[model samples]
Target chain A: MSPIASNDGMRPWRLLRAALCVFVAVCLLSPLVVVLIISFSSAPFLQFPPPGLSLRWYMLLFSTPAWMNSLLVSVELLVPSSILATIMGTAAAYALVRGRVPGAPFIMACLMLPIVVPGMITAAALFGVYRGLGLNGTLTGLIIGHTVLNLPYVVATVASALRVQDARLELAAATLGAPPWATFRRITLPLVLPAVLSSLLIAMILSFDELIVSLFVSSARVRPVAVQMWSNLMGDFDPTIAAIASVCFLFAFLVLLADLALRAGRSLRLT
Target chain B: MRPIDRRIWLLLPATLLLTVAFLGPVGWLLARAFTFPQPGFQNFELLWQRPVYLRVMGNTLLISAIVTPIVVLLGFPVAHMMAHGSARLRRWLVFLVLVPFWTSLLVRSFATAILLQRHGVINSFLIGFGFIDEPLPLLYNLTGLLAGCVQVLLPFVIFPLYSAMARIDPALMKAAATLGAPPLRAFVRVYLPLTLPGVMTGATLVFISTLGYYIIPALLGGARQQMVAQLIQDQIATFGNWGVAGALSLVLLLATGVLLALLQLTVGLKEIAR
Candidate 1:
């Protein structure tokens, strides 16, 4: 690393850089910090330095059926959707990476369309199709929508992991009389298990957090927590919204920790 | 003829899922712009004829243009520090950035709302400090919308910019200095151009993302701040106007495609995949 500049003329620039860094940090973090604090506020409305700390909002969140049901719906939707995405995505990543498929890059780009395209377009399209199929407002519809939305992430992660592994290991297993399925199960699967598991967690978090598509496909009866949060934000200015937001924040924190633990000893890539 | 590769079967499941659920539906929806309500270009015509539709489209582009530079400006220094700072500092900055990145956009927008609302944390703090006599109208306006978008998109720029900066050779800067160029001049003349690929990618991403935003504008913005995505939703939900919704979706998709093409020309889409 380069040494820090020591010239007196450079001191002013260094100080300015430090100040900007602090400003960016505060901008990035203060909103979440404020929400966490207000979630525990005893006041009926959103108040800062909150009148006093209390669990009433959290209690109300648990006690209210709308919030509880949406939470349940989010769990149900993410579980099946994430599992399906992981299975399909892992298979696709493996095929393209090791199967020597022609036009792999083209296929990969097609798979990533869900992510690159505007979520609004995806949501509108699904909402239109589901209208004819009688799938809108159903749990199955939410699952399908989320699976498609989350497929690219899983494929990207697992494919990157597969690229870095030694393809010769699989060839060796095959030459040693291990059948293809057996070789995959014993060798490739074990090696990339962490990435597969990490992608699974990532898929779950994405499905849980997805909003626009859920807003279109979900109804009042089958709303996810994100949809419920949207409705709450539009209608109310209460701390219960903060409480639920904090709950979502907690879920994200746990997932991040699990991901770190799963991928320990490996360097993290920001992309 | 050579037998087809058996491993191609592995791709069948995902391909089928995407074809049936994603491509087929989205394709059919966009096609409805022509076929719906008697197979004419009336939907596109309607969009062109109405002043409000055009205004919303223009407004969406304008907001995105405004948001791109702000995110890049705010993101540049943080990315710079991360690229050049000590290891411990880098770790801390990464954690700070990732925490917000991983958090749900819904939650972050809500948190931002709480902070920007009248009598919210910011206003309360400012008033307590005797900076203002009355609470400022920070929420439900352009200011509120900008705050929400800038905070959410900072990571989009920072990560790309950091990757670019990390790849830059330190000797280039040193060489410029040895030539008697000052630090600011070197940064402007030698350092900036090398980071252009990252800047372009980040700016394109921010611009396109802001164009498609729905939730942030709906929650934090006033009626005057309606964006194209919100307009598309209104067409479907409020009016059940499928033809117009399809037309608007076509426009939005084309804009995204054009930007991606531009990025591919300048930096290669493969760089983004990396």
Candidate 2:
């Protein structure tokens, strides 16, 4: 393709475009960087160009019983919810792609409803329903809500992976005297394992980061870290909040590195 | 009887879970908008008669309207650079965008508060450089709300626009130049129209997302900047008013649905999946 002819007259427009891109990039990244820096500050309150840096805030975060309990609750919630979502979502995706299920598109859309609807609406609805069933303010309620919210991600990712793989391999194994389960275990699962693992990590992150649904269903004793952060934000501007936020950022960074390593040479697609 | 596809059994677990835990609850809540505390239209009437409810709804719409264009304008250049830039630049841009996208909303909002508070980094820098005598009231106001929103929602617009721009044929631009069209004129006429699908899809996503925001407004916004989502939460938590909460939810869902329908009509929803 012939490049748009570069000339002296186009210099100003090019400069303006480049500047705008740089500004947007800084705006996108600066908040996270600032948080990372302030998490190390020794000051009790938020301060810029911090006088001295120390790990006091992080130490406080770990020592506080409230923060520790919320951390435990978040782990307890995300583990079961993410595992359940991944398993069910993988099966559904495989069935839609290969099983020739009737009305697959409609089913897919139905499954995506939790995400398409606003989180606040879902939270209120779940709260109202749980009131009758006496599931409100319980760990089980939070886990169930997070699973529904995260299911769509797993389904979307695995479905894309399955669509890209060669279905003929499974068919070939079947024709070679292998049963359906054997062909699936030997051929299909190995090929899509990376995608399955990636989606599991994504589901876990989504659950850990979830706030609205957890806020509605969880009690003081069953709160996630995000809800805890919200309550802390409502009261004060302590640097301890910044410390916990940095811990969250670090968790996300590690997950990103793992995801990139898992799909090394493949083009990244965020679902 | 004909044998059914055994593979269809795989769909059972997910379907059962969604139907029982998700659809049943959300559907029951929406149904309460009309039927709760005795079946009648009183809830909708209450929303109409009370000026506060109507005003908050109006404010939510106004905030979303303001956010939509700013996100699109800021997102356009970054998306363009990513679509046409060198491989190294594209990779860096993608990394920058995804890192924030994956980070928790709580973390980002907290970070934004740190940077925008009166004695925070930005204000300190301005004062240290002798730009102003008094610190600006940046946090807990409209400016703070907009900053929080535009940062989080930038990726929503950028990715869709990048996908649209990458599909454009460069030859068309060369032809427009050869035919004596100026660069600006060529972009306005030939390029912008082609990117309409992407722009519309991204703008719609941002608008709907802004309408449902609870965390950002709670943290960064002042009393005057209250949105509908917070109102819904307050009703349920403070008053134990499921009827009013359900009614507010209905209004929010209707706004989202109407916009989604319009987007589907203009550009199929599949473009968003792309």
Tell the DockQ for candidate 1.
0.72
True contacts kept of each: 0.74, 0.75
Q: lDDT tens digits, residues A166-189, model 2?
A: 899998999999999999899999
**Mind giving the per-residue lDDT tens digits that candidate 2 earns over B1-274?**
4455799999999998899899999889888888877798899999999998999999999999999999999999899989989999998998889999999988998899989999988899999999988999999999999999999999999999999999999888888989988788888899999899999999999999999999999899999999999999999899887788889999999999999999999999787787
Off by over 4 Å in 2: A1-4, A265-271, B1-4
Of candidate 1 chain A, the 10-residue stretch with the lowest lDDT total is A1-10
- Candidate lDDT (C-alpha), each: 0.91, 0.91
Q: Judged by lDDT against the true structure, how good is candidate 2? A: 0.91
Root-mean-square deviation of each candidate, in angstroms?
2.0, 2.1
DockQ per model, Cα: 0.72, 0.74
- Kindly report which residue pairs in candidate 1 clash with one another: none
